[model samples]
Target: MKTDDAVSALGALANEHRLAVFRLLVQAGPEGRAAGVIAEKLDLPASSLSFHLAHLTRAGLILQRRESRSLIYSADFVAMNDLVGFLTENCCGGASCAPAAQAASKKRRAS
Candidate 1:
């Protein structure tokens, strides 16, 4: 992704509501959740959720599909991976990065 795309994605997630919404969609998996379900789960008004969803869609952080009368939203894993990659492209000079430690920790924990 370009710098501007990453920046826009980060900007969209910078808000508490948008971040929460995105995380919820991630948890929801590829099947996604309907707009009404999101609003109800987040305790957000329909109008507010709509605005947040629009921002997420525009940022390429989420995908929306029309299923019958409902609008389903899901996390765009590719985009998410890109954002993570862009953020950590050169972490700690690429050697002392936390991802290395994190990977080791996961291996140790699993063993």
Candidate 2:
């Protein structure tokens, strides 16, 4: 990810509800969860959830799809890993840090 993209992603996650929502989707796996379910799980109002979801979506940290009558939201794991990479790419100022994000990204791809 570029530095600008990283800043956007981080900004989206900086919120309390947005962070919780993103973490919930990550735990939900690639299949993700519906908007209502996210609201229920995070105890957020529908309006607030909509706003936060839009913010995350615009930041490219999440993906949204129409699953029939429901709108499914899932974390953009690749984008997530890229953000992690951007943050830790200079870890220890070494040529390679082999951060957890890389490992997790590989594992996720394997599945």
Candidate 3:
């Protein structure tokens, strides 16, 4: 993704509610969740949730679709991965750092 796109996605996730919504959608996976379910799970008012969802949608970080009466929302994994790739493209100088970081992550997870 371009830097501007990554910046927009980062800005969208910068808010607490938006970040929570994005993470929740990511956990939900590509199958996604209904708007009502998201509001209930996040304990957010419909209006508040709608606002945050709109922001995320505009940022291209999430996608929304209509399923009968409910609106389903899912994280845009390609965009998310792109943003992560952009952020870590030069991590610790380059490719060599990734193996060490992966090892550390694996060790932490094992513990």
RMSD of candidate 1 to true structure, Å? 4.2
* Candidate 1 lDDT, 1-111, residue by residue in tens: 899999999999999999999999999999999999999999999999999999999999999999988889999999999999999888787577677789999999999
Query: What do the candidate models score in CA lDDT, each in turn?
Result: 0.94, 0.93, 0.95
Residue lDDT tens for model 3, 3-76: 89988999999999999999999999999999999999999999999999999999999999999988999999
> Which of the numbered candidates is closest to the native, going by highest lDDT?
3
- Candidates' TM-scores? 0.86, 0.84, 0.86
Models sorted by lDDT, best on top: 3, 1, 2
Give the RMSD in angstroms, all C-alphas superposed, for model 3: 2.6
Writing each residue's lDDT as its tens digit, candidate 2 over 1-111 gives 777888999999999889999999999999999999999988999999999999999999999999899999999999999998898777867766467669889999999
- Relative to the true structure, candidate 1 reaches a TM of 0.86
Error of 3 at 97 (Å): 1.7
* Candidate 1 Cα misplacement greater than 4 A, ranges: 98-111
The superposed Cα distance between candidate 1 and the true structure at residue 56, in angstroms, equals 0.7
Whose lDDT is higher: candidate 1's or candidate 3's? 3
